[model samples]
Target: MEYQYCETDPFKRPTHLLEANPRGMVPAIREGDWASGESAVILEYLEDRDRDATHKVPLLPTDPRLKANCRLWIDHINAKIVPSYFNLLRATDRTNQSEGIDRLQIEIRALVQAADERGPYFLGADVCLVDIHFAPFVLRLPRMLSQHRHWSDPIPGTRWHMWIEALERNPHIMATTSSSELYLETFDLFMNSRLANGES
Candidate 1:
């Protein structure tokens, strides 16, 4: 199987394999004429292919509760943590900073607890799609955290520190993704523009 990863922001890239599937995003994968889009959907489809497929970590678990817990954490991170990070990025004035930081701290605390609830990994020793779903964002978190003075303490105090450790130690995780320096450059430009424009 061949995977085509579009690394640009979807708005910047415009056209993607998602045009074929209409899932409102990239990170699309094509197998012959078949295509799938949207990170979550593409990940699920790929996971279904085989138990041993390496594109993603295994998702199925022997215990139904563990599976449910994995899915629950995935959803919680997407709904809570992701948005709070964006809020932090887009924060402009002091008010934005205050509210964004508050939300971010709460979400980060919850995420840390959820992540620690299992052990070594989101699902213990072996990683899973839950880990993958959050990997891209987590991989970028350190750089993002560096941009904010407020994040310095929370990052290491929370599961975010563990995330950095995992991603760095695991060669298979986002090994094909761009260098940290590039992400830093673009993120700085993005934050600078957002700050200057009073965007939130």
Candidate 2:
């Protein structure tokens, strides 16, 4: 499955492509001919297609309950954990910013506790559906936190600290995502603009 960065959305998303998907959401996959949308459903399709094929990553856990648990964790982070972090960076009011960061910290702490059960990935060594689902956001968090001063230290002492460290050091992640240099460059630009605006 090749990924084409949508010109309109630099974050790699397609608009009309979602028409095939009833929900019109992203993170969709187009196979040899068929297409599927939604991260969880797409992930399941990929896993099923890779079951007998070589050269692809396995997403489903060996245990049924563990697979369900991974999805639960993904849902928690998507609906609660990630939105909290996003709110902190996007909040306009200083008071709202503080509240958002506080909420994000609380959510991260809980996620870190649950994440401790697995080493490396969300389900141990193997990267599963949940890992793939959240990988982009988690990988980008450091850069986002650094760019937005109000979002710094939002998840101190959380599982993300270690997870991020490991991610930064991973060859696959480094090859796939933005480099530290790029992150710093963007962070500096964002900070300069915020400072110029006299924003708190």
Candidate 3:
């Protein structure tokens, strides 16, 4: 699979993205006539499709209970952490930003506490669906928030930091990671204006 940017601006997203995803959310994938949107659903689609083909390298754990647990956390990240991050970034005043930061920190701390005690990865030995879903925010948040909001890492010396150190070392993550300059530039643009459907 290939990845690409959505070419977003302050006012709107690209036309093609709206055509593919009516909700205007991203992490959308298209292959000919078939297309899917939303990060969680797209991840499920990839795993199922990959399972039918190779049956090797499952992103989700094989156990039924473990897989369901992964889904629960994914929903937490989506419904809580992600929105908090965006809300924090979009906040214009100190009061709103402080509230946003507090909310985001609480949500993040919950996720950190949920991770396995073993050093690396949420599930403890291998990267899984939860990590993939959260990695973008992990990679970008430090620089973006620090530059804009003077935010600092609140959960240092926790399981979350350990897992992040591992993620930073992952070859695939290193390969796909964008420059800080580019990320901050895009973030600066969005800080002033809003985009729809949790995308920007």
Candidate 4:
């Protein structure tokens, strides 16, 4: 399938992408008139298409309990950690940034506690949906937090560190990632634009 990358600002999307998925979000996929928005929805669509697992890796496990558990954690990440990351970004002032950092750390600590005790990945040695859901925010948010808020790593030398190291070594994560320099530049620009607009 052909890929089109564009500005992630939903209100400012290019017409083609806006047509492909009316939500105007990045990570939308379309084929002709058919399209899907949201990463979780897209992942479920892909999983359903390959239900027999004859082609492509099965991201959700075959076991019913394991699959449900992964879904639970994905929801937690979506509901908790993800919102805190956005809050942290919008928090340009020192007091708000501190609140953002505390909020994120609390959410993250809960996630770590819920994760498999034996894991570098959420589900023991294998990468799963929980890991996938956490990956984008986990990779992008911390750098912004550190650069803009003087945030140091929270829960260092613990499972957080192990989990991050495991994700870093995963081929898919490594391959899909942009350089740290570019990541910083893009995030800084977004933050600055928000600040200019007096967005909280």
Question: Number of clashes in every candidate structure?
Answer: 0, 0, 0, 0
**lDDT per residue (tens digit) for residues 1-200 in model 3:** 56565544424666777666766666577767878777788888877877866536678988999989988999999999999998998887888888988998899889878888885888888889899898988887776988787677646776877877888889977777778887888786675455534544
lDDT on C-alpha atoms for all candidate structures = 0.68, 0.64, 0.80, 0.79
Work out the TM-score per prediction: 0.77, 0.69, 0.84, 0.85
**Model 1: per-residue lDDT, tens digit, 82-171?**
888887777767688778878877876676667755444676677777777777766666666656635553345345566557765777
Best by TM-score: 4
Better of 2 and 4 by TM-score: 4
Q: What tens digits encode model 4's per-residue C-alpha lDDT throughout 1-200?
A: 23444445443577777786887776787766888778899878766766775655578988999889889889999999999988887787789989998998899889889888888889888888889889887787666667777767646668888898788788977766777877787777677778778775
Which prediction has more favorable lDDT, 1 or 3?
3
At residue 23, candidate 2 shows an lDDT of: 57
Residue 102 of model 4 has an lDDT of: 92
Model 4 residue 196 distance off true place after TM-score fit, in angstroms: 6.1
The TM-score-based order of candidates, best leading, equals 4, 3, 1, 2
> Model 3: runs farther than 4 Å from truth?
1-11, 52-55, 154-157, 195-200
* TM-score of decoy 2: 0.69
* TM-score (C-alpha) between model 1 and the true structure: 0.77
User: Model 2: per-residue lDDT, tens digit, 1-200?
Assistant: 45553312212234556544545455555655677766667767767866977766567777888878887888987898778765676576778877887797787667667774646666666666776666666766667764554456435444566566666676755556766676666555545656777874
Clashes of 1: 0
